[model samples]
Target: MDTTALEFSLPNAAAEPDPFSIADLSPEIRFAVLFFQRDHYCTNCREQVQAVADRVDAFRARGAEPVSVVPEPLDRVEQWQAEYDLPYPLLADEDAAVGDAYDQPVRFGLLGSVSDFLGRMPQIVVLDRSGGEGDPEVVYTYSSNSTFDRPSIDELLATLDDLAADGETTSTDG
Candidate 1:
């Protein structure tokens, strides 16, 4: 895949720029852990959000920044931020364009496409951008088959560790 389409700009709950763009991140952020939510009402999505929040530091420690993308409007996303106070970026993909770009699957075909709650699944995309230039590569992607399915944070950390061990670490102190 070209992967260029993955880049996007959306409203953010915690960012100096107010609106957050995935293309803009710390130089030290070699990996961007994009947690794509199904919707605001998803219990699994909420738990995953908090889980990522709890371990945002660990992700940063491994040269990764966890970003939660809620496929809802700005107001709904703000409510989540007010409740969880996520330490990392909380983006509102209001039109779900980003999710579709990343190929977040629709299980039941046309029926599933009608409602995000009944069909849209969770996804995690780890984008690797080792330097200040170039498009972030899609290093890792996990698309949930079921609503309740999700990989543990430890598993994601291990993936980062493995990537670093394989000499793919591109994080720099610029």
Candidate 2:
């Protein structure tokens, strides 16, 4: 997918209509790692988020910030964050527009007949913001076809290292 063309208006607890664009977030974050999850109630989703929470320091060390996007209401987003002790912001994609933007799978091909079913498969996006202003550039995009498909924490950390080696720098200024 052409991530540079991506745009979303999800809500954070403290802000309404928070854009994924790094330029809009203060302190000029160097990178934005967006994690798209199926639902907050899923055990695997909780585990995946916990993994991200555990390695958040590693991401921050590499000048990247991790944000989670879920197809839940703002209340649920906030509740889930507190319940799981998530270390980063979780955006409320209630309409699933962001999910559609990231091309999340909606149905299993053979199981398409499942009643009222909608695929909320998970995925991760790593955006390089060191490009300096304007829209952030997507350096990595991982979309999972199944519930169990997710990049390991090690793999994500290594990707952050690679981006840093490629000259992505974290910002300490507001």
Candidate 3:
């Protein structure tokens, strides 16, 4: 069975308020973000982040805003923005609070010891415009060890299409 076909459990809404809920954003559009570690960088992470940023317009065309969230400092984010030539905002989650909210965890199991810990895998999350309080659907997910088989840009676009086709109007800000 393909991992892509597996349904991911939504985050517990009561666990904590979504970081996006605190932002003053447009309620007319859906929101999505590629969450990543702040200081730790990996070639695969860079590739995945760039891929999403490059094709964000495709999401916008479908009435969604795509962004990248990292646990980096403002200066580092600016450097990355210039280096990557990012078009959308690159958020700074300084304390990894956002990452924690997303259930990102660094596991030492694979390394055989706590000293050999590796960062959490990359993940993409989609949020409905209207915040009614509950888990938002996880349209796509891939483990850190499974980066080689991560979905392509086309595949992600298709997934978004399927998610939007469900005929449910995302909640709206009243």
In model 2, the runs with Cα more than 4 Å from the true position are 1-5, 14-21, 109-118, 167-174
> How close is each model in CA RMSD to the real structure?
5.0, 6.1, 9.0
Q: What TM-score would every model get versus the actual structure?
A: 0.90, 0.80, 0.66
lDDT of 1 by residue, 26-131 (tens): 7877888888899999988989989988888899999998888888999999999899888888899888888988888777888888878778888888787864
Question: What is candidate 3's local distance difference test score?
Answer: 0.51
| lDDT-based ranking | 1, 2, 3
lDDT of 3 by residue, 1-174 (tens): 121111122221111222333233455665454444324365665676678777878978876666566665556555676678766556666555666565554554546223212545555555554343443444444334433435667866776686677733221111
Candidates 1 and 2, the one with greater TM-score: 1
- Greater TM-score among 2 and 3 belongs to 2
Highest-scoring model, TM-score: 1
Per-residue lDDT over 109-154 for candidate 2, one digit per residue giving the tens place of the 0 to 100 score: 5463231135667778777766665677777777776778887888
Residue 100 CA displacement from its true place in model 3, Å = 1.0
Residue runs of model 3 more than 4 Å from their true location after superposition: 1-22, 37-40, 109-117, 130-143, 146-149, 167-174
What is the TM-score (0 to 1) of candidate 1?
A: 0.90
